[model samples]
Target: MRAQPTAKSARCTACRIPSRRVHGFYWRSLGDVACFGRPILLLIRIRRFRCTIPECPRRTFAETLPGVARLPARQTDRLRSVHRAIGLALSGNPGARHAATLGVPISRSTLLHRVCSSDADPIPPVRVLSVDDWAWLKGSSYGTILCDLERRRVIDLLPDRSADLWRRG
Candidate 1:
Protein backbone atom coordinates (compact mmCIF):
# COMPACT_ATOMS: atom_id res chain seq x y z
CA MET A 1 0.00 0.00 0.00
CA ARG A 2 0.99 3.67 -0.47
CA ALA A 3 1.23 6.20 2.40
CA GLN A 4 2.64 9.59 3.44
CA PRO A 5 2.97 11.77 6.52
CA THR A 6 -0.19 13.76 7.25
CA ALA A 7 1.34 16.36 9.56
CA LYS A 8 1.50 19.83 8.08
CA SER A 9 4.73 20.76 9.89
CA ALA A 10 7.85 18.71 10.62
CA ARG A 11 10.96 19.56 12.58
CA CYS A 12 14.25 20.06 10.77
CA THR A 13 16.61 17.21 11.62
CA ALA A 14 19.65 19.50 11.70
CA CYS A 15 18.27 22.69 13.26
CA ARG A 16 15.17 21.28 15.04
CA ILE A 17 13.01 24.04 13.58
CA PRO A 18 9.39 23.27 12.74
CA SER A 19 8.57 23.87 9.08
CA ARG A 20 5.21 23.98 7.31
CA ARG A 21 6.54 24.58 3.81
CA VAL A 22 7.32 21.32 2.11
CA HIS A 23 10.40 21.45 -0.12
CA GLY A 24 9.56 18.23 -1.95
CA PHE A 25 8.60 14.58 -1.56
CA TYR A 26 10.18 11.22 -2.32
CA TRP A 27 9.06 7.62 -2.52
CA ARG A 28 10.36 4.89 -0.25
CA SER A 29 9.69 1.18 -0.63
CA LEU A 30 9.69 -0.85 2.57
CA GLY A 31 9.26 -4.53 3.28
CA ASP A 32 6.49 -5.40 5.73
CA VAL A 33 5.25 -8.45 7.58
CA ALA A 34 3.28 -11.06 5.73
CA CYS A 35 -0.52 -10.93 5.92
CA PHE A 36 -2.85 -13.81 5.15
CA GLY A 37 0.08 -15.90 3.88
CA ARG A 38 1.28 -13.10 1.56
CA PRO A 39 4.17 -10.71 1.93
CA ILE A 40 3.41 -6.97 2.03
CA LEU A 41 5.35 -4.09 0.51
CA LEU A 42 4.55 -0.52 1.48
CA LEU A 43 5.23 2.44 -0.79
CA ILE A 44 5.64 5.50 1.39
CA ARG A 45 5.54 9.06 0.08
CA ILE A 46 8.09 10.82 2.26
CA ARG A 47 8.02 14.59 2.61
CA ARG A 48 11.13 16.77 2.77
CA PHE A 49 11.23 19.89 4.94
CA ARG A 50 13.56 22.80 4.19
CA CYS A 51 15.92 23.92 6.92
CA THR A 52 15.51 27.72 7.04
CA ILE A 53 18.41 28.32 9.45
CA PRO A 54 21.38 29.75 7.57
CA GLU A 55 23.81 28.19 10.06
CA CYS A 56 22.29 24.73 9.72
CA PRO A 57 24.41 22.36 7.64
CA ARG A 58 21.49 20.45 6.17
CA ARG A 59 19.58 22.18 3.38
CA THR A 60 16.63 19.83 3.62
CA PHE A 61 15.66 16.82 5.69
CA ALA A 62 13.28 13.95 5.15
CA GLU A 63 10.53 13.30 7.69
CA THR A 64 11.42 10.53 10.09
CA LEU A 65 9.07 7.70 11.01
CA PRO A 66 10.50 6.68 14.36
CA GLY A 67 7.64 4.31 15.19
CA VAL A 68 7.51 2.74 11.73
CA ALA A 69 11.18 2.18 10.98
CA ARG A 70 14.64 3.70 11.29
CA LEU A 71 16.51 5.41 8.45
CA PRO A 72 18.37 3.33 5.86
CA ALA A 73 16.30 0.30 6.80
CA ARG A 74 14.42 -1.57 4.05
CA GLN A 75 12.08 -3.45 6.37
CA THR A 76 9.48 -2.29 8.88
CA ASP A 77 10.32 -2.27 12.61
CA ARG A 78 8.10 -5.21 13.55
CA LEU A 79 9.21 -7.25 10.54
CA ARG A 80 12.86 -6.69 11.33
CA SER A 81 12.22 -7.59 14.93
CA VAL A 82 10.65 -10.86 13.87
CA HIS A 83 13.59 -11.62 11.62
CA ARG A 84 16.06 -10.81 14.39
CA ALA A 85 14.29 -13.08 16.90
CA ILE A 86 14.31 -15.94 14.41
CA GLY A 87 17.98 -15.38 13.71
CA LEU A 88 18.89 -15.35 17.41
CA ALA A 89 16.91 -18.52 18.13
CA LEU A 90 18.07 -20.54 15.14
CA SER A 91 21.20 -18.69 13.85
CA GLY A 92 22.81 -18.83 10.36
CA ASN A 93 21.36 -21.31 7.87
CA PRO A 94 18.91 -22.80 10.31
CA GLY A 95 17.40 -19.39 10.97
CA ALA A 96 17.09 -18.64 7.27
CA ARG A 97 15.38 -21.97 6.65
CA HIS A 98 12.93 -21.32 9.44
CA ALA A 99 12.21 -17.78 8.26
CA ALA A 100 11.46 -19.07 4.76
CA THR A 101 9.15 -21.66 6.16
CA LEU A 102 7.34 -18.91 8.08
CA GLY A 103 6.96 -16.92 4.79
CA VAL A 104 9.46 -14.21 5.75
CA PRO A 105 11.75 -15.32 2.87
CA ILE A 106 14.96 -13.72 4.15
CA SER A 107 18.46 -15.00 3.37
CA ARG A 108 20.79 -16.44 6.00
CA SER A 109 23.28 -13.58 5.68
CA THR A 110 20.54 -10.94 5.97
CA LEU A 111 19.16 -12.65 9.07
CA LEU A 112 22.62 -12.71 10.64
CA HIS A 113 23.22 -9.07 9.72
CA ARG A 114 19.93 -8.03 11.29
CA VAL A 115 20.78 -9.84 14.50
CA CYS A 116 24.27 -8.34 14.65
CA SER A 117 23.21 -4.80 13.77
CA SER A 118 20.48 -4.58 16.41
CA ASP A 119 21.53 -3.14 19.76
CA ALA A 120 21.88 -5.63 22.62
CA ASP A 121 21.24 -4.97 26.29
CA PRO A 122 24.33 -3.64 28.07
CA ILE A 123 26.10 -6.25 30.16
CA PRO A 124 26.76 -5.43 33.80
CA PRO A 125 30.31 -5.24 35.17
CA VAL A 126 31.94 -8.46 36.25
CA ARG A 127 32.04 -8.84 40.01
CA VAL A 128 33.38 -12.37 40.23
CA LEU A 129 35.78 -14.08 37.83
CA SER A 130 36.88 -17.62 37.16
CA VAL A 131 40.33 -18.32 35.72
CA ASP A 132 41.59 -21.58 34.29
CA ASP A 133 43.96 -23.03 31.74
CA TRP A 134 42.58 -24.14 28.35
CA ALA A 135 44.67 -26.30 26.05
CA TRP A 136 45.38 -24.72 22.66
CA LEU A 137 46.55 -28.07 21.42
CA LYS A 138 45.91 -31.43 23.07
CA GLY A 139 49.44 -31.48 24.51
CA SER A 140 51.42 -28.82 22.63
CA SER A 141 50.27 -25.45 23.89
CA TYR A 142 47.92 -23.93 26.44
CA GLY A 143 46.15 -20.60 27.15
CA THR A 144 44.45 -18.91 30.07
CA ILE A 145 40.68 -18.57 30.09
CA LEU A 146 39.07 -15.75 32.05
CA CYS A 147 35.33 -16.00 32.66
CA ASP A 148 32.77 -13.73 34.26
CA LEU A 149 31.15 -15.85 36.93
CA GLU A 150 28.16 -13.54 37.40
CA ARG A 151 27.28 -13.47 33.73
CA ARG A 152 28.36 -17.02 33.06
CA ARG A 153 30.26 -16.03 29.95
CA VAL A 154 33.89 -16.02 28.88
CA ILE A 155 35.45 -12.59 29.26
CA ASP A 156 38.81 -13.11 27.64
CA LEU A 157 41.46 -15.61 26.71
CA LEU A 158 45.11 -14.97 27.40
CA PRO A 159 47.64 -16.28 24.91
CA ASP A 160 50.09 -17.58 27.49
CA ARG A 161 49.23 -20.13 30.14
CA SER A 162 52.05 -19.01 32.45
CA ALA A 163 51.08 -18.43 36.09
CA ASP A 164 52.86 -15.08 36.16
CA LEU A 165 50.92 -13.81 33.14
CA TRP A 166 47.60 -14.76 34.66
CA ARG A 167 48.59 -13.23 38.00
CA ARG A 168 49.60 -9.96 36.32
CA GLY A 169 46.32 -9.74 34.37
Candidate 2:
Protein backbone atom coordinates (compact mmCIF):
# COMPACT_ATOMS: atom_id res chain seq x y z
CA MET A 1 0.00 0.00 0.00
CA ARG A 2 1.12 3.55 -0.76
CA ALA A 3 1.45 6.10 2.04
CA GLN A 4 -1.24 8.76 1.96
CA PRO A 5 -0.05 12.36 1.63
CA THR A 6 -0.92 14.65 4.53
CA ALA A 7 -2.05 18.29 4.42
CA LYS A 8 0.30 20.30 6.62
CA SER A 9 -0.55 23.61 8.29
CA ALA A 10 2.01 26.36 7.89
CA ARG A 11 2.30 30.09 8.69
CA CYS A 12 2.37 32.79 6.01
CA THR A 13 5.71 34.41 5.39
CA ALA A 14 4.23 37.79 4.52
CA CYS A 15 1.50 38.02 7.18
CA ARG A 16 2.96 35.73 9.83
CA ILE A 17 -0.39 34.03 10.50
CA PRO A 18 -1.15 30.35 11.15
CA SER A 19 -4.93 30.70 10.82
CA ARG A 20 -5.16 30.30 7.05
CA ARG A 21 -7.15 27.39 5.62
CA VAL A 22 -6.77 25.40 2.39
CA HIS A 23 -8.23 27.27 -0.60
CA GLY A 24 -7.60 25.96 -4.14
CA PHE A 25 -5.18 24.26 -6.52
CA TYR A 26 -2.93 25.64 -9.23
CA TRP A 27 -0.34 24.41 -11.72
CA ARG A 28 3.16 25.84 -12.09
CA SER A 29 5.95 24.94 -14.51
CA LEU A 30 9.40 24.72 -12.91
CA GLY A 31 12.84 24.86 -14.50
CA ASP A 32 14.34 22.04 -16.51
CA VAL A 33 16.42 19.47 -14.66
CA ALA A 34 19.99 19.19 -15.89
CA CYS A 35 20.69 15.67 -14.73
CA PHE A 36 17.30 14.31 -15.76
CA GLY A 37 17.04 16.55 -18.84
CA ARG A 38 13.35 17.24 -18.21
CA PRO A 39 11.18 20.10 -17.09
CA ILE A 40 9.37 19.87 -13.74
CA LEU A 41 5.74 20.81 -13.23
CA LEU A 42 4.17 21.38 -9.81
CA LEU A 43 0.51 20.62 -9.23
CA ILE A 44 0.02 22.47 -5.99
CA ARG A 45 -3.17 22.67 -3.98
CA ILE A 46 -2.73 26.07 -2.38
CA ARG A 47 -4.33 27.17 0.88
CA ARG A 48 -6.36 30.31 1.53
CA PHE A 49 -7.54 31.88 4.77
CA ARG A 50 -9.09 34.95 6.32
CA CYS A 51 -7.03 37.00 8.78
CA THR A 52 -8.33 36.29 12.28
CA ILE A 53 -7.03 39.63 13.56
CA PRO A 54 -9.33 42.54 12.83
CA GLU A 55 -6.46 45.03 12.87
CA CYS A 56 -4.56 43.12 10.20
CA PRO A 57 -4.53 44.85 6.80
CA ARG A 58 -4.76 41.79 4.55
CA ARG A 59 -7.94 39.69 4.77
CA THR A 60 -7.07 36.80 2.47
CA PHE A 61 -3.84 35.28 1.15
CA ALA A 62 -2.77 32.09 -0.59
CA GLU A 63 -0.22 29.62 0.74
CA THR A 64 3.33 30.67 0.02
CA LEU A 65 5.78 28.59 -1.98
CA PRO A 66 9.32 29.30 -0.82
CA GLY A 67 10.93 27.21 -3.58
CA VAL A 68 8.81 28.83 -6.30
CA ALA A 69 9.78 32.30 -7.46
CA ARG A 70 7.92 35.53 -8.18
CA LEU A 71 4.16 35.03 -8.40
CA PRO A 72 2.37 35.37 -11.79
CA ALA A 73 5.65 34.93 -13.72
CA ARG A 74 5.48 32.29 -16.48
CA GLN A 75 9.12 31.24 -16.62
CA THR A 76 11.04 29.78 -13.70
CA ASP A 77 13.99 31.48 -12.00
CA ARG A 78 16.54 29.47 -13.97
CA LEU A 79 14.85 30.34 -17.27
CA ARG A 80 14.79 34.02 -16.29
CA SER A 81 18.53 33.80 -15.57
CA VAL A 82 19.09 32.34 -19.04
CA HIS A 83 17.06 35.17 -20.59
CA ARG A 84 19.12 37.74 -18.68
CA ALA A 85 22.35 36.15 -19.95
CA ILE A 86 21.09 36.27 -23.54
CA GLY A 87 20.01 39.89 -23.12
CA LEU A 88 23.49 40.87 -21.88
CA ALA A 89 25.48 38.95 -24.52
CA LEU A 90 23.80 40.00 -27.77
CA SER A 91 21.52 42.99 -26.85
CA GLY A 92 18.75 44.44 -29.09
CA ASN A 93 17.91 42.62 -32.34
CA PRO A 94 20.97 40.40 -32.43
CA GLY A 95 20.28 39.21 -28.92
CA ALA A 96 16.68 38.38 -29.77
CA ARG A 97 17.78 36.30 -32.74
CA HIS A 98 20.33 34.43 -30.65
CA ALA A 99 17.70 33.71 -27.95
CA ALA A 100 15.31 32.29 -30.59
CA THR A 101 18.02 29.86 -31.69
CA LEU A 102 18.36 28.73 -28.09
CA GLY A 103 14.58 27.93 -27.93
CA VAL A 104 13.76 31.10 -25.99
CA PRO A 105 11.55 33.55 -27.88
CA ILE A 106 12.56 37.17 -27.21
CA SER A 107 12.15 40.48 -29.01
CA ARG A 108 14.46 43.49 -29.24
CA SER A 109 12.10 45.71 -27.27
CA THR A 110 11.69 43.03 -24.60
CA LEU A 111 15.46 42.65 -24.31
CA LEU A 112 15.84 46.41 -23.95
CA HIS A 113 13.20 46.44 -21.21
CA ARG A 114 15.05 43.71 -19.34
CA VAL A 115 18.36 45.54 -19.66
CA CYS A 116 16.85 48.78 -18.36
CA SER A 117 15.07 47.00 -15.51
CA SER A 118 18.27 45.45 -14.13
CA ASP A 119 18.82 46.66 -10.50
CA ALA A 120 22.43 45.70 -9.91
CA ASP A 121 24.13 47.60 -7.10
CA PRO A 122 25.06 51.22 -7.86
CA ILE A 123 28.61 51.77 -9.11
CA PRO A 124 31.12 53.21 -6.65
CA PRO A 125 31.88 56.97 -6.62
CA VAL A 126 34.54 58.29 -9.00
CA ARG A 127 37.24 60.97 -8.63
CA VAL A 128 38.14 61.97 -12.18
CA LEU A 129 35.55 61.93 -14.98
CA SER A 130 35.38 62.69 -18.72
CA VAL A 131 32.58 64.32 -20.67
CA ASP A 132 31.86 63.87 -24.38
CA ASP A 133 29.16 64.91 -26.84
CA TRP A 134 27.45 62.92 -29.59
CA ALA A 135 24.95 64.05 -32.23
CA TRP A 136 21.60 62.32 -31.92
CA LEU A 137 20.06 63.97 -34.96
CA LYS A 138 23.10 65.08 -36.95
CA GLY A 139 23.34 68.87 -37.14
CA SER A 140 20.00 69.19 -35.35
CA SER A 141 20.47 68.05 -31.76
CA TYR A 142 23.25 66.71 -29.54
CA GLY A 143 23.65 64.84 -26.24
CA THR A 144 26.41 64.64 -23.69
CA ILE A 145 27.63 61.71 -21.61
CA LEU A 146 29.80 61.74 -18.50
CA CYS A 147 32.07 58.76 -17.99
CA ASP A 148 33.98 57.68 -14.91
CA LEU A 149 37.36 56.19 -15.86
CA GLU A 150 37.67 54.27 -12.60
CA ARG A 151 34.15 52.77 -12.74
CA ARG A 152 34.30 52.40 -16.54
CA ARG A 153 30.61 53.31 -16.86
CA VAL A 154 28.53 56.24 -18.02
CA ILE A 155 27.62 58.30 -14.96
CA ASP A 156 25.28 60.93 -16.40
CA LEU A 157 23.65 62.13 -19.61
CA LEU A 158 22.74 65.70 -20.54
CA PRO A 159 20.78 67.40 -23.30
CA ASP A 160 23.90 69.06 -24.67
CA ARG A 161 27.58 69.21 -23.83
CA SER A 162 28.34 72.68 -22.46
CA ALA A 163 30.90 74.37 -20.23
CA ASP A 164 28.09 75.13 -17.73
CA LEU A 165 27.21 71.43 -17.54
CA TRP A 166 30.86 70.54 -16.89
CA ARG A 167 31.00 73.08 -14.06
CA ARG A 168 27.76 71.72 -12.60
CA GLY A 169 29.26 68.20 -12.51
Give the best candidate by TM-score.
1
Q: Which residue ranges in model 2 land beyond 4 Å of their true spot?
A: 1-7, 26-46, 119-169
Give a tens-digit lDDT track for model 1, residues 1-169: 8988798888998889888878999999999888876778899999998888888899999999887988888888889989989989999899998887777879989889988984533467899989888888978898989999887899888887777874675
Q: lDDT: which candidate is best? A: 1
lDDT of 2 by residue, 112-163 (tens): 7766764422467789898788777889899988889886888878888677
Flag clash pairs in model 2. Answer: none
Residue 162 alpha-carbon offset, candidate 2, angstroms: 27
Model 2 lDDT, residue 24, Cα: 50
